[model samples]
Target chain A: MAHITVTVDGTSYKGEVEPRKLLVHWLREDIGRVGTVVGCDTSNCGACTVLLNGRSVKSCSVLAVQADGSEVTTIQGLSDGNEWHPVQTAFKECHGLQCGYCTPGMVMATVDLLSENPTPSEQEIREGLEGNLCRCTGYHNIVKSVSYAADLMSAGPTKGAK
Target chain B: MIPVEFDYVKVTTIDQAIAALKAGGEDSKIISGGQSLVPVLRLRMAEPSVLVDCGAIDEMLGVREDGGSITIGAATTHHAVMSNPLVQKHALLLAQATATVADPAIRHRGTTGGALAHADPAGDVPAAALALDASFTIAGPGGRRTVAAKDFFLDYFTTAVGPDEILVSFSIPKCDWGSHYAKFNRTAQAWAIVGVAAVVNVEGGVIKEARIGLTNMAPTAVRASTVEAALVGASSAADITAAAMHAADGTRATSDLHAKADYREHLARVITARAVRAASGI
Candidate 1:
């Protein structure tokens, strides 16, 4: 077993993980961050996407030990508890999900995308979220949510805590 | 899916990594980004007894210029390669191809060396590397050696990198040629069914030299030498199209679910023509 110290959702957690333990599994099982769900462990469906040191990556494709000295932000940690993240609020407002299985990953990917390209064209938004898949084929709404989220974020900081 | 348990070791330097690889022997796997290795492990495709995490190895990272060549650390992430000024200015083909690799998340985690060492023919970087004539620098207990990109990839998912050797970096000669990577994939984040990377060195509105790299059109990334031979000193679009017609000559393309051999061969010619035309600015 390998010992790892990682900060998730602003809280540091220390644990002994097997070498083969994936970051998605470690986050869900050890760190109790179930918000980052593992949909397709093959890295195709980016359902386990999370912020690793402010950059988004599929947790299923990363070993827990690789993230030992890194800071992780999951879906549950996207907001300050009082208000929803801009992407989350946009998803709700734009009806960006159906069945909601891939919503967390979609929202997280949008946050990373908008952070990089504050204002993206329709094609850019679609291309940006290509990694994250929605089986419901609700991409039309998901793209809308990203556009709405870009607007929300560009409007300035959220009403709640940073 | 869960991977088989394995002993893990983290190395901070190339020497330490080589030492671990030597100690672990053939049963060990060196993981840089874990983007490719982890997926295979989860699928039980490979069950290595040990995993040497070289992610923190400071010696094997970054992109820098050495005279007229750009030496990219094997551990440099695809995102870094895409954003590096030297790469964008000197070798834009790499940047163009790297942009088409998977999506944003994978780009942030996947490394250039891992992609080359993994040696997936469908990977965008290998074809780009071949077209750009990049040399892979490998280090082992026996010390360091450089292998040309053309000779680095041996077969499907295999490379010239030995079990005890780590691909340290890739050195590519700088080129001021117009380059483009045209990929045809079924869906977003899908591997290229058939792709072409073209680099054209044009002078006085005439093609002086042409290098074409084919992906997923053979057992390994193969160069369209026949087409290249036909393209030198060619200027007109008709000349390029006629030359690109020979793109699949002397190739051992195979058929898969994504496409048939004939279809891939056809795509080789068509995409090669398109890539050459765009690259030569005609």
Candidate 2:
């Protein structure tokens, strides 16, 4: 076992992890950050997407040891107290999800996408979220949510949350 | 799916990585980015006794200019490769192809050397490396050696890199030619069904020279020498179309769930023509 120090959300967690342990398993099973759900164990689905060192990466594809000195931001850490993040607010306002199984990943991916491209066209938004898959809502509302989220983020500080 | 338990050693230098690999024996595997290796590990396809994590090797991490070529560290992620100004200016084909690899998340974590060393025939980068005439530098206990991209891939999921050697970097020559990578995939994140990488030098509206690489056309990435030969001095769209007919001349394409052998051959012809046309600005 290798000892590692990983800062998740905002808290630093120090522990011993097996070399074979995936970052997603360690986050959910070990630390109870179940907000980052695992859809397809394979890397195809982006349900396990999280920000690693300020860039998005699939947690399932990353070994826990690889993230020893890194900071990871999952969906659980997006909001501040009772106020939701701009992305979470946009998803709720635009009805971006139906079953909501893929919402956490979708919302996290949107945060990363908007960070990279603040103003994306419809085609660019679709292309940016290509890794994420949603079996419900046909992705029309999800794309709308991303566009709305972009508007909310660029409008200075976020307003009162619902 | 949990991978089998294994010992992990993280090394920050190439020499230290080599020592770890040598000590771990032949069953030891190197992990960089872990985009491809982790998936295989979870599937239980590869059960290495030791996983030497070389992702933190500082010396093997960025892009630099070496004389007339750009030497990219093997551990450079695909996102970095696509966005690096040096690579974008010198090896645009590589940037274009790297941009099409999986999605944004995968690109952020997948390394150029990891993809090249993995050597999946359906992968997008190997063909781009071949078209750009990239050379791989590998480091072993006996020191370092460079292998041409053409001779690097030996078979399916195999390369000239020995088990005990670590791929250090790739040197791609700078070219003042038009290039394009035309990939056909069922989905945005899916592997290429049949892809073509074309680099063409047009002089006075006539093709002066051309290099073409085929993906998923054989056990390994192969050059379309016949099509390249046929494209010289071609000045029209019809000329490129006619030349692309020989795309599958000596390829050993296989039938898979994505496409039949014959269909892949047909795609090779059609996509090669499109790639050449776009590359030469015809």
> Which candidate number has the best TM-score?
2
Q: Please, what is the TM-score per model?
A: 0.98, 0.99
Q: Per-residue lDDT tens digits of candidate 2, residues B186-276?
A: 9869999999999999999999999999999999999999999999999999999999999999999999999999999999999999999
Residue B143 of model 1 has an lDDT of 90
Q: What's model 1's lDDT at A113?
A: 96
Docking model 1 quality class: high
Model 1: per-residue Cα lDDT over A79-109, one tens digit each: 8667788888889888999989998899889
TM-score result, candidate 2: 0.99
Each model's DockQ score? 0.91, 0.93
RMSD to the hidden true structure, all candidates: 1.3, 0.9
Please give the clash total of every predicted structure, in order: 0, 0
Steric clash pairs (candidate 2)? none
DockQ, candidate 1, comes to 0.91
What fraction of the native interface does candidate 1 get right in terms of contacts?
Answer: 0.94
